[model samples]
Target: MTSVWVGERVRLRAKEPDDWEAFHSFEEDSDAVRNGWRLHPPSSAAYAKKRTAEEAEQRPDLDDPDLVIATRDGNVPVGSIGAHHSDRDHGTFAYGISVGTPYHRKGYASEAIVLLLRYMFFERRFQKAEAWVYSSNDASLALHRRLGFVEEGRRRRSHYANGRYDDEVLFGMTIEEFTALHT
Candidate 1:
């Protein structure tokens, strides 16, 4: 069996088709596209397949990062995480994660982020990790800060969401910074 990323409360492993079945959009307050976290939900299975293919084209040297977060006890599908735009030459990557509505506040997302980062940094030998989140996304902002991602920059009023423009914040962490946090 392939190795899985196990954390205190969650496990990061291969995404099953069931995971896609359980996949859903965020709450009204957290509409991913408007918040600038994603472009749109896959329209259909065919579209999802095509999207995956295109993503593979962009990341020729790498396979898809299909890490799904599930409860360690029952292995119930809760969310998905991906490390995209990976630069093996530079040992850097950008990542995004999505959690199902039913899975919120169960610490699934929190543990998944930790496990994914650990796998990327230690297992994959990555040096730096980055993510973009809207400044209005208090949950994400707080999570990134708590996880040691520093604010690298910001683009004010760059994204239009919820009938108004919201600022996009860039957060990043280096291997050194990650080590300082975990060690």
Candidate 2:
């Protein structure tokens, strides 16, 4: 049977200990880091390897650990995606995705997101999914819209990056809406 985590061009898989180099490469993209929730100093190779080991150790117990986004044909790691701020009581959740600098605009992010949404809404019984995007990140903003997520709200000047503040745009989609569009 086809896997739920498998998509057209990308597949979401458990992060492996050997995936440290790909994770570390993502950190090197200054724009990606700045557009993300927080900006931090550069990560060393040792730190990345350590983090990968920790994630691998934690994966079995976690319902939705950060997953590696890899090319379907060769299984080459390109990025990562993860669910966050999950509220099982309310059937709501949020997620974040990051594609490496070299892999941008290749449709890998889109397919990975669809796979995650399908798993969350269908298998996990989440009613709604939300994503927070920085205003500075135009690509992400467009991607959410293209995927049929509605703009629910925005927090004004809530995120600081690149010597300035950017609004955090909140986008949401319900299970019904996802079914309508993706099914």
User: Which candidate number would show the highest lDDT if scored against the true structure?
Assistant: 2
Write one digit per residue (lDDT tens) for candidate 1, span 44-63: 76655554445434522332
**What are the lDDT figures for the candidates, one per model?**
0.73, 0.89
> In candidate 2, what are the lDDT values of residues 1-183, reduced to their tens digit?
899889889989888899998878778778788877676888788899998988887734244557889999999999889998889899999999988989999999999999999989988889999999999899999999999999999999999888999999999999999999998
lDDT of 2 at 48: 90
The most accurate candidate by TM-score is 2
Error of 1 at 38 (Å): 4.6
Report the error of model 1 at residue 20, Å. Answer: 3.2
TM-score of model 2 relative to the true fold? 0.95
- Give candidate 2 misplaced runs (Cα > 4 Å): 61-63
Worst 10 residues of 1 by lDDT: 55-64
